[model samples]
Target: MENISFQTAEVGDALQGSNPAHLYPDIFNQGSIHTYDAAMDQAKQMVLKFLNSQKKPFSGITPNKLAEQFKKIDFDNPLKEYEALFKEVDELYVQHATAFHLPQYIAHLNCPIVIPALAAEVLVSAINSSQDTYDQSAGGTLMERQLINWTAKQIGFSEEADGVFTGGGSQSNLMGLLLARDHFALHKYGHNIKYDGNPLVAHRFRVFVSDKAHFSNQKNASLLGLGEQGVIKVATDERFRMSVDALKDAIQAELELGNIPIAIVATAGTTDFGNIDPIENIAEIAERFGLWLHIDAAYGCGLLLTDKHKHLLNGLERAHSVTIDYHKSFFQPISSSAFIVRHKSLLEIIKHHADYLNPEEQDYEEYPAQINKSITQSTRRFDALKLWFTLRLMGRHKLGGYMDAIIETSKQTAGLIDSDPDFELLGDSDISILVFRYAPTHFSHDTLCDLNQYIKKQLFHAGEVLVASTKVNGKFYLKFTIFNPLTTMNDIRFMLNAIKTYGAGYLQ
Candidate 1:
């Protein structure tokens, strides 16, 4: 046989020679790590400036304009391009960024991320590991698994639970619902539905959620092909929490109509009112009906950190699955969320086989074959690294303290609202959110709501603050969502005073 060149040599050369530390000795130290440290410091300064001055709400960049701009960019001379882009960005657009860290930013559920978590983000991104497979993300996968165990324990689930990081609360809810849908259907009908599609496991599958549940629950139901109408929105009580009696009645009604109750979604903390559904009561109902229980505790997942609020999610252990958002509750950056299942094997619903990605078979001794599980598996980012860093730097107790502080501050703000005769505190504060209206006189309920909505719009146009509006008892009212720890009672008071001051003319 003639001596022939093989591709293995080329692969080996590509792997070893492509290492920047070896190829670019001038920009890097021969062996000392300080050179890389200095480079990282420079990159950090440049990145921080970019972040501080980035545009808010994405600068309203149109797709066509963005496409044209992308085409004009060149990477051959990357450093020049980088400098020019940074200059343009810092000069033209930095002031428009949403001032999330500012004390007055009390409009939405967003809050400034913890400084430690923010720092970890840059370091984690620089490493860029994919978390889907073990080899690709050996330490990263282990970190995620450990974090999942901690969260599962926090929720009072058994040691057999498993979870995966998702894009956000929305994707977390989808994964939770997807597992619930598939698992319940398979247990009742058979596993064939996994491949064929939604067969007649029952005439129709129904999901029960309170009126105060986040819209994502219904949205997920629709996206899962369960139909938007499949979500049964049960009535809430005066405090906006799901009424157990109403839920029982709704479930019985579904049974009477010959519909299958697939899942009962109990929310730990609602988005609008911060109302927590009666988990213990709902758990009993779910157990009796043999329905899958899912808790959408995305916004309130931080409650797990506090002993006081932890009991609020008393029956979470009974849940088949749970959706929690670390971004909202843990003060991590955006896109930190998870879908947790009590039984680890239930994740198989998301598993699918592909010959190209994971060949059918491999030698068990030499190579371990990959199991295709997870809702999304291809080209995934290592989001879990930052989360692991967050948990390590700030233990569960400290994280819980942060949550307690927010809830306590909310209570104090409600007290301030109550002391003022001009303000009507919507309901007694139990969670971190308070929805109220500035009503000084004998205006009808409907009229008071209209006045509050008017004030909300006026505040937005003025660009001073952004408060939300929602209806209660068919009457409109302005809502103050206090997710930012930087927000104080004084800020809430100022916002109220502003509303009443600017809306004084509308009062008459």
Candidate 2:
């Protein structure tokens, strides 16, 4: 046997430019590896240093500043410039950033995404699979299909259910509305309108949603050419769930005004209060009016994972379509969302053909085309992989258990607020979101609002901890979104203490 020869490479020499084989024989034998290693190490170090310096979770940079910074970077010749620029980035950008890793990051609807999902995100990015078609994604496509079926089953939908991975809840909502729009229009006007566009029919298409419903539904309506005026914002009861009587009134009013009530959008997990709209009641109204029903369960969809909280979303099965975001409540990374329809053929609303992309011959007896059934971007990312990997790794039982713990923790926080003389509970917490305001000894509601707002600004600038703020009934309140598994009852107590300490000065 011939003796194998090996060569060692030095990092500093590689940075200064070295032999291709000596630097990275495995990946870039014909190219230099030292430069790449040096670049990656410096990049990693710079990121670490920057993160260490930040006082807040983010740089708070404006779009103009961010755009300017992007333009200033020399992408074509970055190695040398990156080494030098990263040092300045250390001094300027990184030092001002807020670190989310700390126990104090309790603010916003955002959560500390699972580490496994993060790893999976990196893997998916490196591979760059488009899950829109079987041919492009191959095994990846199969993974998404399996995940769709599994999630549908989890949500109590039949085994024949089908769905598409979306960018996020907003996109998911848009896709759902698009389907609803087409379903209603096709049934009324006859034939697909998604491809050819709505045929300016006599009836003015419109949708109904509660005042507590996410703005995404209205936004989706506008994007689909229905216009913001097309969405009828129904009234909510004291608990913020859609009032069934108000919904019926709205539909009747729309009909009286000679408008087409195409769909009714119900919310599960409202942004401010985490309230679940009365889905069953809304479904009954939809059924009565013969309108398509959609549930925007963006933040509350995780309840389906647990039988304990599943009853909160009882009417979800009756929805013609539903939207779920893993990023919000499932401890998954951003952009992990899906839109599911009860009937697979309902997606025919988005059906169309383009010979260049998906040809005719592809539609055979054995393998038919699956391209025309989607409304969003053509090159969809393999977002389902992270979600699939997450379920497989931490089964639904564990996921639900984790959520139950968080919800219980949130209740404890709410209890603490209600008991504290300095704090007042605003609305109730359904999942993990608690909204409350400081109630200083003699301060009025207005004064309390101002005080809580001040405390929020102070805490944000302090960078020691973070919490979100929202307004209810014209009063400002602090929002505790307990998505971080690391966030504990102690953390909640510390936050309450911080608010009292910082807000006491605002007391009358």
Candidate 3:
């Protein structure tokens, strides 16, 4: 085989080389280490440009225009040089990608990633280990296990607690619902749902959640053989927290109607208002009714690390299960989250043993495989490494400080809106998310809705400052989810000014 520069190697060179290994990428066998290094250097540069650039978070590029760019690209033809490919990628993705780290990006639940976690991402991708079995992952498996252990401790779980990392809040929510459905069947009627499938009475199985709860509950119910109607939406208090009084009434009403109350889902951090469902009150009710309680703390899990704010998640320790999204609150990259159970044995409801892969191990402690505990996935990425790296480097207190900062910023921003005559503050939150709108008193409700919607569209199209929009009680409201700890009062003011500027223009 001729010594061909991997970066500049083309199909013509492989034709001359006798070694067939040159025909395909040898990255799997360490054959293209130099090329890998070059690719990393190029990627680092691309991202550095994004970090240093003064450009807007969004490119203000329309879908049709962006689609036109992709439509012309010929994927079939190979680029001989890595530099050429990187340039094309820079134009297509990096230039137009949403920059979450920017201070003006106070929209949605997207968070700015910490530096330590990004370093971990490089290790995760380069290793390319599937966490299904110990043999496949080796040290990576134990790292993920220890991270789970740490997360369980953070949730106040005892020694018997266990969980597995999942893709994100959606998958974690699905696992919680799945376990709720199966565990109810096995314990209540001694029917094994794993093999027996959903029982005949599955139609009567009901899951209770607050009206302000994430929409994933209904979708999860649909996936577990329970239709959307099977999930009940209990009323919430003025702050958007689940009403304890209403929950009791809902359960009694369901029982009277002959519907089985299988589980109760409490939101530790709701999407719209960011208010937490009264978890302690709900947990007590769940215990009295013998209903499984799952806390969806996907957006609020960071409260577990904050000394000042950890009290906000007081009853999470008592819940049967909890969902945590490190990507959202912990400032980690995407796809880093976990679904944890109070009792390790509960995970058996979803466990499966494969002889060829993760064969039955009598002593699970000695030979453990994560695939046995996972549902809806056989091959899992080493996403846990990012969180592990974060803890080892930054420690819990430092990362929690980030959450505290964002929360404090949100409180100040809410007060700003309250004092402003032009903007209307809808409600306060337990965390950092605030739902408000640019409502001038003179405008009718219908006109205000159109004006706020126009403001959101205008800001997005101009790419000046991005803010989220949500409808509250059939009225349009703009939401500011301050997830970036570095986002100062100035950034919030900048976003608000843009909304007002656009709102004023809309009236003209």
TM of each candidate vs. truth: 0.84, 0.86, 0.95
Model 2 lDDT at residue 451: 84
* Candidate 3 C-alpha lDDT tens digits along 1-508: 8985554466546644755545666455456777778788998988888778846889888999899888778878978888998899988988888888888887889999999999989988988899988888989889988988888898899988999999989889999899989999999999898999988999999899999899999999998889999999999999989999999999999999998999999999999988888888999999999999999999999998899999889889999899999999998999899999999998988888877887775566787789988997888899999999899999999988998898899899999999999999988888988988898887777799889899999889898798898887898889998888888898888888888889889978
Better of 1 and 2 by TM-score: 2
- Looking at candidate 3, the ten consecutive residues that score lowest on lDDT are 21-30
Tens digit per residue, CA lDDT, model 2, 421-501: 877787676788888887867776556767888888877766666889887767788887787666788887887888888
The per-residue C-alpha lDDT of model 2 at residue 310 equals: 81
Error of 2 at 110 (Å): 1.2
Of candidate 1, the 10-residue stretch with the lowest lDDT total is: 362-371
Residue 138 error, candidate 1, Å: 1.4
10 residues in a row with least lDDT, candidate 2: 364-373
- Badly placed stretches (over 4 Å) of model 3 are 1-28
Q: How high a TM-score does candidate 1 get?
A: 0.84
User: Candidate 1, residue 506: CA error in Å?
Assistant: 4.6
User: What is candidate 1's lDDT per residue for 37-151, written digit by digit as tens?
Assistant: 6656666776576566542323433346545645645668565444566554544445344556555566678866887787777757767777766667667767777788888
lDDT of each: 0.76, 0.77, 0.89
